[model samples]
Target: MRAIQITEFGGPEVLRLTELPEPAPQPGRLLIDVDSAGVNYADTHTVENSYLAASSLPMVPGAEVVGRTADGRRVVALTDNGGYAEKALAAEHLAHDVPDGVADGQALALVIQGVTAWHLLRTCARLAEGESVVVHAAAGGTGSLAVQLAKEFGAGRVIATASTEEKRALALELGADVAVDASPEDLTDRLVEANGGRKVDAVLEMTGGPVFDASLAALAPFGRLVAYGMASRVPPTPIEPARLMGRSRSVIGFWLAHCLGRPGMYHEPLDELLAMTADGRLRPLIGAVHPLSEAARAHEDLRARRTTGKLVLDVRA
Candidate 1:
């Protein structure tokens, strides 16, 4: 099997494509013939040795994949590691069937990003109908899905923020009621205008650091801020209690991996979310497709923000 391996963690240049022995399935695990894999900021963080959970040296760093099980059934899975390859072994319980009409790349895109959006809206934030929300990185994988999920859940207005105009436009296409450039100094003002001068009930925050404070400020009274990722490369900053007290706001941190570890906590949401995609209420966008051999290039594109929507690596290509 051909896989991208990190003999040492340092930079994107360290990812090397090499041949490895094929893996076999254990009693409770299934060996999958990977068709596509999802690349995320977490994979970038892991390559740089900055992820919450440190990976072993010479590791293959992919978390989500869409492929076929040992029995040849199409499925999506969250692999702990070792997904940037032609084949991967995953626990049976961690895999879910891919719907009939979904393509491999699209299915892979949805498993991680889509599930995150679903959990954030339905569980973490408890988003309500006719409420307003502000989604950061609205052009990216999870952001795009989050926008649709928020609208499907009955958000009266969805305000999406992106670093570039192209990204903003993509967000609007995906279902955001309004889209704004996120680089300006007065994000709160822009968000207010987008929402007709109304404060947002929830802010789906993926870019952390300074954006955290701004997201907090943009919230309505009793609003919830869900911090999911720190794509900005800034260290996590502390928020003062007074900030929360001022608006009676709440900030909650979410990591899809944590939820995956506790299957009982996320099973229902995952089922409903997959159903939404299967039924056509939701769709996962495949922004770019790269051959598995060009895994490093995929990582580079993601870090540079050169790609929007979901970036998938074609393991079979």
Candidate 2:
């Protein structure tokens, strides 16, 4: 099997492709003939040993894969080991059947990004119908899906923010009520203005620093802001508990890793997202697909913000 292994924590340059032996079978784990692997911004953090969970050395770096089992069932699974190889190991329970209507790359998108978008809205933020929501990085993988899912869940207004005009347009096409430049200089004002001069009720925030501060400042009374990732690699300012109480606002944190193994948390929402994709209600944007050997390039493009939507590695290539 061919895999991209990192012997030390560093940048994309550390992801080196090499031939490796296939993973031996383990109890309760199934072998997958990997077709494609999902690439996430978190993978960048994982490589640098800065993610929420610590990563071990001399290891492969992908967490989700779209592949077929020995029984010939096409499935998407969350792998505890790694997915950046021709063959990988997946827990039987973590694997879900891929609907025939979904392509391998699209199905791969749903595993991490899709599920995170769903949980951010339904679970962590507890968004209610008719609530106003703001989605940052609206053209990226989770952001794109979050934009559409907000509307699907009956949000009264969805404000999407992106760094580029093209990305803002894509967010509108995906169902955002309005799209605004994500520049931090006037972000708070723009977000409120986009919501008709009113603060938002829920926010799906990833980038930290000014983006986080601006979004937090634009929240309505009783608003909930969920922070999942810090793509900027800059931490947000610490919050004062008294300030949140005075404003009746919440600053919640969510990590998908924590949702794993919880009943009806991972699989249920994923199934819903998969069904929506099958019916054409949700579209997974596969911005770039790289061959397995070019894993470093994929990481580079993602870190540089040179690409949007879901990034995938075609292991078979």
Candidate 3:
């Protein structure tokens, strides 16, 4: 099998395309002939050994795959083995059947980004209908989905923040009531202004550092902010419990990987996401599609923030 292997922890340059033996079958895991793989910001961290979870050497650097099991079921799965290859291994429990009419890249999006988006609004944020929402990095995969999902779930106001005007426009088209530049220095004020001069009731914040701090300040009383990823690669300042107590605000942390331990938590939302996509209620923007060999370049574009929507690798290409 040809895979993008990282023998040492480093940058995108270290993702080398090389030949490797097919994974030996294991209990509760299924071998897949991958058609496409999702490229994520987390994969960038995985290659550098800076991800939340530790990594082993000479490993592939993908987390999700849309492919087929031996019985020929077309499925999308969170792979236990690396996904940047023609073949990979997916834990059976983590794999789900791709609905008819859903594309491979679309199915791939539902696995990680989709589920995260769903849980951020419906679970962690505990968003109530007619409440306001702010989705940071709103042009990216998870952010884009979060923007749409917030509105779908009955948010009265949806504010989207992105780095560029083009991205902001895309967010508006995806159902956001307002779109603003995600400038950390002015983010808090902009978020409040965009919400018609009111603080947001919920926020899906992934960027760390100043972005996180600013979002924290732009929350309404009893507001909830769900922190899922730190695409900026910077950690936020520690929160003072006293500060939260005064406003009755809450900061909640979420990680999709932790949900893998309980299959229902991972599958229920995924099933809803897949149905939404298949029925066209949800539209997943497909970004750049790179061949298997260009995995490194894909990582470069992702880390440089040069792309939007879902990034995919055509494994069979």
Candidate 4:
């Protein structure tokens, strides 16, 4: 089998494409013939040795893929590692069959990013109808879906933040009431102004450091801010519990891996998400597609924030 492996923790330059013997199915896991794999910021973290948990060396860093089981059942699967290859192993429980009419790229996008987006608003933030929200990285994978899901869930106003005007345009087209350039400075003011002077009821914040502080300030009283990722690769600004108490605000954390530890936590939402996608209520964006050999470049694009939506690696290409 052909795969991309990081023999040492470093930059995109470290992701090397090489040949390896095929892996066999474990007692409880199925071996999948991967058609498409999703490249995520977490994969970059794995390469840099900076994720929530440190990665083992000589690792294949992808965490999700869309592929087929041995019998040819189309499925979306979660991988602990080893997704950047023509074949990978997936726990049967963690993999879901891809519905008819869903493309491989779309199904792969739904595995991690889609699940994250769904839980961020519906679970972590406990988003409510007619409430307002500010979604950072609004043009990216999870952010794009978050924008639409917020509207679908009945948010009164959705404020999306992106790095460039073109990305911001896509955010608006996805149902955001307003899209603004992402800035650590005055982000609260910008979102408030965009919301017609209303502070947001929820903020989907992942970038840490200065943006974390600014996002905390942007929240309305009693608002919840779900911190899911540190895409900036910086230490998060600490929160003052006393500060949150006075405003009745909360700072919450979410990790998809944590959900995997809980029994049946993902079933309902995954079903809803799949049904939504199948019926056209949801559309997972495939920002760019790369050949398996170009895995390093895929990492480069994600680390540079040069992507607009989900990035997929096609093993067949």
Which portions of model 1 show Cα errors greater than 4 Å?
A: 261-267
Q: If both were scored by lDDT, which would come out higher, candidate 2 or candidate 3?
A: 2
TM-score of predicted structure 3: 0.98
lDDT accuracy of residue 168 in candidate 3 = 91
Tens-digit lDDT string for candidate 4 (1-317): 99998888999999999999888879999899999999998888889898888889878879888888989899898988999999999888888988897888888777788889988998889898899999999999999999999999999989999999999999999999999979778877898898898777999988998888888888889999999999987766677788899888999999998887586567567778888989999988999999999999998998898998899998988
* Shift in Å, residue 85, candidate 1: 0.8
**Poorest 10 consecutive residues by lDDT, candidate 3:** 257-266
Give lDDT tens digits, candidate 2, residues 1-317.
89999999999999999999999989999999999999999999999999888899989989999988999999999987588999999999999999889998898889899999999999989999999999999999999999999999999999999989999999999999999999889899999999999988999999999899999999999999999999998887889998799879999999988888899988998899999999999999999999999999999999988888999999989
Off by more than 4 A, model 3: none
Better of 2 and 4 by lDDT: 2
Candidate 3, residue 272: the lDDT equals: 92
Q: Please provide, for model 1 over 218-287, each residue's C-alpha lDDT reduced to its tens digit, 9 standing for 90 to 100.
A: 8999999999988887854688898789989999989887777675655566677767877888888889
Query: What is the TM-score (0 to 1) of candidate 4?
Result: 0.98
Compared to the true structure, candidate 1 yields what TM-score? 0.96
- Measured by lDDT, the strongest candidate is 2
In model 3, state the lDDT of residue 310.
97
TM-score for all models, in order of appearance: 0.96, 0.98, 0.98, 0.98
Enumerate residue pairs that collide in model 3. none
